[model samples]
Target: MYTKDKYSLRTVLLWTRRYIYIFVLISVIPVVLYQLAGWKWLHLPWRPIGLVGTALAFISGFKNNASYGRLWEARKIYGGIVNASRLFATMVNDFITNEFTENNKTDEELFLIRKTIIMRHVAWMTSLRHALRVKKPWETSGNNTSDKEHMQSIHIQEYKYTLEEELDGYLSDEEKNYVLDKTNKQTACLNLQSKNFKELKMDGLIEDFRHMEFKNIIGELFALQGKSERIKNFPYPRQFATLNSFFVWFFILLLPFGLMHEFEEIGISLIDSLSGNEIYFFIAKNFIWLTIPFSIAISWIFITMERVGDVSENPFEGMSNDVPITTISRGIEIDIREMIGDDKTEIPNPHPEYNNTQM
Candidate 1:
């Protein structure tokens, strides 16, 4: 996610400029009809429009809260993965031993076993992250033309490498091919891990209780993976999203008509306050035009609120605002590999941030 202190006014304005153009037109059109065409009947009473604005605020608040809850839950699930991965790696390095084995193995043999198992876990993480990054029909950051244009300016590591190629770094050729052939490659990787873990149990390298513990960690990892996939596959309800957009635009379109009547009356009263100076009368009467900018600014506030929630609902879409799952996955790899005695130089470097976001 974005790690900056705050999004500056310039950044917020630039990000939302497309919507601003539409808001300007929505505000100005009614003003033009009311003023230039002398369509006084088009000016609406401010009270009903004010009521709609209030309802819009309540609805937008509900949507944003629900969307943010999804994003936070996704983050927590990955947090669980990070913890469970480290625990599993430590078990690989420490739990299995010659303590119960028929033939005593050398330190080198034990170390090799630890490294292989940790690397397999790393492969599982890789496949799970790739699955999360896959675009769903409801996601906007990678799907829409305008959002795709914006994303082009930012670099995502997953986009730089193919899933098959990346899996090669952690999985054997046979294992990678087997996984690639499956519908859920991550699930396949987990099955491979469980199979290897079971073999260790059968060989007496790990005792029965220790084997059970290892399976439990794997089960936790599987649960975490499934949670993330559920969020990625099942979208926030489209009904709430569709109607939120319509209602926001509907309120904005009607906003200027109500504002114009209010501003014009204020302009006329101000003109009557002026002492008979022709220039002052002209300036005071024309002040009604200030409603255009006011209307645009207010409409922008409501629209921006709606847009924030819209984009936040899908946390794995590789958007700059999404949870930094790729970065988190890489970090876990580094940690687990280091625990298994891999050289620091052999480990890949951390993912670099793009536009203040790590993804």
Candidate 2:
């Protein structure tokens, strides 16, 4: 996600330049036909176009609100994961003890135990982020030519490594193989964690109540996973998205037809008021051409709003505007490892950002 205070105007304009080109063409066609081609019938009435614009405004606002809701929900799910992970780490570090075990382990052995569970939790996180990054048929974040080119400036770490490769240092060979064999790797990792905790409980490493508490946290994580998967799997209602696009385009194409006439009338009034001034008359005579820029500006605003909703609808699509799951997962890993007193140097650095964006 963008870490800067806000996206620069240059970035926003560059990102939408291709669309602006199309808008320019769309706006120019009708103005040329009406003014130069002398096709008087090419101009449209303002009332009908105004009605369309008003309807388009409502739908655009609705779409943006829904898209923002999806984005915020995704972020909140990750926030819950962050909190649960911290709690899990704290419990694992302090609860497992000789107080409940007859066969006591050395301090080093206990630390190893704590480290193993914590790392597996990190593995679960890695698996989840990787799963979420998997492309769905409906996700179109970087599919466009412009977006594909722009994505080069942002680093998405999940694309750089396979799940097996990322799990290398975190999971044992047998566990890794077991996880890789599963349809849902994150669920598999969590299953492994639950099994480990159960074994620990049986061996008296934790009291019965504490074991139940761990199980509850595991269940909460499972619920959070499902929530993330739900959003990733099911896209924003395509009916709304598809129709919104049609409406916006229809409005853009119709804009210049209505706008050129209004400007033409204004130019006529100006020419009449400055009847004897040749320079003012010349300028006023051609002022109808200003419709091209005005139409483009209006079309750009509407189209940009529509595009914003489109991009925000899928928060896990690895776009610059997506949730920074990679960074968040790494931060959780760092915090959990520190909780267990892992060597500071051994913890990997946080994922690096590019162009003030993280993925």
**Which lDDT values do the candidates have, in the order given?**
0.85, 0.90
Best by lDDT: 2
In candidate 1, how many Å is residue 247 off? Answer: 0.5
Instruction: Give me candidate 2's TM-score against the actual structure.
Output: 0.97
lDDT of 1 at 298: 96
Q: After superposition, which runs of candidate 2 have C-alpha atoms over 4 Å from their true positions? A: none
**What C-alpha lDDT does candidate 1 achieve relative to the native structure?**
0.85
Give the C-alpha miss distance for residue 259 in model 1, angstroms: 1.1
What does candidate 1 score on TM? 0.95
lDDT (Cα, tens digit) per residue for candidate 1, span 284-347: 8777688899998999899888877887899887766678988898899999999888978889
User: Ten residues in a row with the worst lDDT in model 2?
Assistant: 2-11
Worst 10 residues of 1 by lDDT: 2-11
Backbone clashes in candidate 1 total 0
Candidate 2, residue 31: the lDDT equals 82
Residue pairs in candidate 1 whose N, alpha carbon or C atoms collide under 3 angstroms:
none
